[model samples]
Target: MTKERIGHPPHPFDPARDPVHKRSKQGDSVGGAVVIVGGGYSGAMLAARLAERGVASALIDRGGDFGRGVAYATLFEGHLLNVRSARMSAVDGDPGHFVRWLETHRPDHADPDGFAPRRVFGDYVQHRLATVDAACPGLITRITGTVAAIGTDAVVLEDGRRLKARAVVLATGNPAPRTAPAGASERVIADPWAPGALERIGAEDDVLIIGTGLTMVDMLLMLEGRGWRGRATALSRRGLMPRAHGPRPDVPAPLEAGLLEGPLSGRLALARTVAGREGWRSLMETLRPLTADAWQAADPAIRGRIVRHLRPWWDVHRHRIAGSIAGALERLKADDRLTMTAGRVVAIRPGAASVSLDWTPRHGPARPALTADWLIDCSGPGHDPARDGLTGPLLASGRARMDALRLGLDLDDQGRVLDAEGRADDRLFVLGPPARAAFWETIAVPDIRKRIEAVAAALQ
Candidate 1:
């Protein structure tokens, strides 16, 4: 079969002359329409919302997994959502949307508070997209291919096909783990999420994971599913595991308006003070409504300080795991099968059978060299555009610039991509984790859904 180049030939729609609900003929394609560059959760939600508003758009992704980004693409039964089913809706105002979908589709596993498998969540997202596509017909076009560059008026695919669009949305999701350590590519697995990433390991092979965050938790779960009996070592700067989520309280803590106005230390101190009265979980929940505002209101220096000093602590408390996963982790620890260390890797040497690693503890002297059959870089995605494929051209062409933190692309409060000259582009928009530079909480589903709703409203 001949390969069809993946990209929607844009659909024609004139806001002034065309009926709002008019549906294009099947296979009819137009130009200068909305084109979203990623078909993951962000892009899927945005497209669905736009379709709900009688708008037409094209969704492009390399993997062609319209709703399942890297996060939910995992088929592992043991990998579950960190958030409960009740709060994992794709729509902004529909808190129970996902739970309702689960009831209709997978009733046996549809507990509102239970953490559903990531695959189930992926199914829910795909179902939403399918529902929208059926209702809107040709309004949502699915394109499967890599977007190589973002031109001023079009997106250039890897195969040199340029699809013109009036507006472009960069919902490209998270980056892969930093490139494997030099000369250790064969022994190091840079992306734990990649297909077949763990297929080469034997059941008893020693494994070293580079981070003690959610990714490491995922790796551990996958290993256990494979019946791995070898030792696993997780190393991080703080060696902190994500806290487990308990039953959410019936009532939330009172809002503290003053929390965002003070110095970083003062704000943290206030949070601690409140945590003393209401538990830490409640304090964090209370801060949820105000997180974006508080993050934006803080001085850049203060934000930097928070990232440098309190990030690890914040991460553990902010991104909690499921109780079941936590129990499994504890069991592994109890069985002396897992080790968590706080240290810095001094050097890495590749060997025929294993990789040699030299690490120094955070506070202690250097330890003896260690060896691992496989070293997985689970430190999460790096945010540098210069090092990324799609964004690199945008940066080189001055079409985009890095944020002050260099954690993501520079964007305005309205989610417009800013040029190298620091000017926001009217027709170019961005959502998802890359917008974290402007909205610190953009990585989560709730935040992404809100952003998608806003962007869709604005485009409409």
Candidate 2:
């Protein structure tokens, strides 16, 4: 295959004009189609990119919509994106693609620096996919179903359908939030993003949210929008809420060459010194582009130390909330309507009317038991690959292996999955959060878009 043909595959291999067989017969040869599991932004964007390049792909998702994953599926107007519009482009080379889309579709809210509602961004993603699909008709097939497992050269669906493909990309995005030890109960809302879960709470319900990160912020916004007059308490180990966004700082000067190579602790000390001079936010902004490189360079022991000691602080400062949302949260705190507690729930007793929780503070002894009319677990997405329904089976079957730190599926530099014996699979790949083990900064749109470009360029 020539360099030019890498993107624009020969017409004979075009699955668009000629669809791949639904199922492979015994002893059948490999097909030309690519199957992408997970219809979230990553998967959808990958399909669009492949389609534009004259390759054929099947995008499978359990959700009804193609691009509106859990993060963007919110209908609440208060669900604004954490990142500014100028930086949230879905196109790799075009940083202002999203802002341009906003100017055309929503002229009233076209400020490049302003945060747009996530739902609108979801619409923008779907629109882009539609445009690509129209341009390359039949190149991208949309399948609405859950993937049961991945075979050697095929994607098996939960409904018993099999799609034979030359390559399969796992873009399953973030897994569902981990359930609490209390188990399932009507009074406990395990996953706040679940359809109609928040709506079930009455306006007078006293709520206990077990997280203080972005997901916790989301829960607060949802409650405030519903005019819930009752008090709410958010608990976490460190009580570290995400900081609010502000004016973008100018890019800082490069770090010293010596600062970039050292133990994680030494690097962190360097970060502290820089933050003392330039401020923490500026340091975080400066570190954004360099995080993945630094992470990939670190040894597993260093990575483990970072995860155990610095992850929470890194998350709050790195992934900030919208300024408007921050102000609203502050107002609630000032009014004594919302409380942020640093603690862990030691025990949960479910009663007919309410749930009682015994929480132990970070620095103090166990506090008195508190009762809540409803309990919501917004502790964020689960991280264990072995716990994942679709990918778990692959790991058990020795088809895939977890990363050294168990942060995500083990993947090579090229996004190919590493098998149980530490071999990269040429025909299988992982993307987005599932591949976070290899690329620490793979979750954001800009990062994932660039990844799609690389993967598409490398496709055989």
Candidate 3:
């Protein structure tokens, strides 16, 4: 357990005492005793939970925008929450918490099944944090800066300042996607979600997007909202698009005893049988409760095969998009404004005003090179910590190690980060996307809220 250091009455955070503003000697301590790195959804929620438990903490974010994070920081109204509002409660053990908050805060979108804009959800998160802080003043000290390293009992900032912390929670969510191919030049938008990434492109320029998952769908929606007249081509290996949301079953479909206890192939076969009878949506929702156990129980070789060959299929079926969004995509394809191609990009050649790529079709021989005014890589967030700048310091110092599959950080079953020596560090813990390797179903709201509760219990 973490050393008990936050058992005193809370005080509001004073900017004058913030360690970043004033230089600190080797051991000068300041701010909340417990520090949380990353003010995004996971970090903010954890801080709120801790504060409610009377544990003061310092919440730090490089972007300085608390609660929004990458997922909810969007100004685009078209980017809606993937999950329905009824299940998006910020409070754990209270399923209707978000719905009640929505009725009071955003009545226009108060329907229990309606999908709220992500920005509104961001507002809700910020409001919850503020409300908790009001009740427990001085507990959450919000700091805006990039974290350089985490010491035994302090957090080092890039500006050479340090905040003394008895414990640290690395809630740095999704890292930016991997860099594009070498010499892809300025036409390649490596990360579409970056602020103003698509602003420079001409309205009529043709686009070639990599990947056909939800990120690709988001790009299309953003482009359509921008009133762009450009045509787009979404390229992927299997060209399978995300399934649309459907009516959830009143009762979860039952699985045979020990159905998921067998090999990966056997489990997939069972999934097919269930989908054929109860529909794909029912099959996916039913599997949610057991996915992590199934993932853990599988042999390492089977896990690798699942990732390489069946991941896209699993993702599309499990992470369904809103019906309206799916309809928009269908209309775009029907209008000849969008194209979906199944292929693999072989090489890229940069051009002065555009980018050219040579790719092989999934079924045919090498095809003619495709050229586009801009090549946007819509591949999802990168998970490797070693390549991430913020998480790199931990890897360099041997305080953290990557999982065997390189999905995310290596973590114990309790969500504590594992060091290079394969021992869990009590002073450090991980939550949300960074813990994906250990918890397969952790990225969604329902799963994340439960994780926050568990981590809060462990911390206290």
Candidate 4:
């Protein structure tokens, strides 16, 4: 068979004439005090928080079971948390719950400091759900179905049902697996979380993953779990692997009370403070509590500047991987089982059995071509309205609109949803990553836990 090549396709934009577009699938009326459209970390924590506040809440999940979102629902045994057990509790009220659980349950398990199996973490989240079930403080329900539409004050399910509520939370974790480059579909493994994503590999098969972040780590461990010995290549702009978290360093608070009130000069002052700190982990640990303040202090203009200059560096620095995962990656690099190439993808061609990829490596004169038996788009995509399959129609139809970053539903400072004219919707509320404009570092469990608490408090 002739080797087919592939590369960068195009930026996604299609509300009309797009094959993936669909209308709202309104379900039967199911009234919830607060209807959350996702079942991930953010949604689960918010549900419990709402119950604590004596509010009725219901969560609808596509996966059906309670605690398993795309990030947590992997059946693969080798997938582990990038964070340590101490930082991984599903609930913010009990910071050490995960660590305590590990000690009580899997004390004998190896590498407790390293990444723990994602299954155990998922189980802990499930257990939290079970606890909420027993309490019955306020109405919090879970439905197993897809989300079809999100109205101004209601959530519509795929089965043509709607849950009109005072608030709606879009806690859908990560976006769907990206569509591969044109002609790359034959060898594309679009969804990493899908069943048999790694199992499709043969012992001698070569694999190419689009990014070298946590998902790549998951893929590595999954293959290692299956005893599949193969060559894998990861490509990205920097090709920089996530930093492994070592012993928690003693990072002092970097900013004072006025540090958050930023206008470029103040930000420089904070940058100087960070400069004094030892490393990225120390910088983040100090900035954790102060993040919301800093985020709110900067106007959208500064935020955009940061996105352009600092976001990529911040991601690698802040989102450090587990020590064990990093160690394994180091070993793989040493053994040449795993390889990472730094560059932008130029093209791809999917053949019957293998996909050919063309990449420009770090401004190097020569663009290289490599073939892999399978390719997974680990380059994380945003949970755009279209990908979520619920809010997209509303946005295109002028019922709603995207924020500056085109992430989640747009909202005002007080957490009120914004309509197409950039006006706040009185009866609607948004939470989690969709509210990222209000809270920059909100994707983490610790951050989400705190946000959920505030969301609950605000609702009361």
Candidate 1 matches the true fold with a TM-score of 0.92
Models 1 onward score TM values of: 0.92, 0.91, 0.90, 0.84
Candidate ranking under lDDT, highest first, comes to: 1, 2, 3, 4
- Which regions of candidate 1 are displaced past 4 Å? 1-30, 248-250
Q: Please state the error at residue 229 of candidate 4 in Å.
A: 1.8
Task: For candidate 3, give the lDDT.
Answer: 0.80
Worst 10 residues of 1 by lDDT: 1-10
How would the candidate models be sorted by TM-score, starting from the highest? 1, 2, 3, 4
Q: Is candidate 3 or candidate 4 better by TM-score?
A: 3
Give the C-alpha miss distance for residue 281 in model 2, angstroms.
Answer: 1.8
lDDT of 4 by residue, 1-460 (tens): 1011012222121112223222211222246467887887778767765654456678888877677677778887667776766677665555566666566557754344556777777877876666655554335688888887777677777798877876676677767556465334757877777766666688778899888877777788888878878889999888877887866533555545544554666665676666576554666676667767666766678878777767776788678876767788899889998998899888877888788888888866876597888888888755556545666676777766776765467666666667799887656566666677657777777777777766766665
Of 2 and 3, the candidate ranking higher by lDDT: 2
Query: What are the lDDT scores of the predictions, listed in order?
Result: 0.81, 0.81, 0.80, 0.69
C-alpha RMSD values across all candidates: 5.9, 5.6, 6.7, 11.9
CA displacement after TM-score superposition, residue 32 of candidate 3 (Å) = 5.8
RMSD of 4: 11.9
Clash count, predicted structure 2: 0
Q: How do the residues 258-329 of candidate 2 rate in per-residue lDDT, one tens digit apiece? A: 557867677788888888887787787778887887888888998898888899999998888878999999
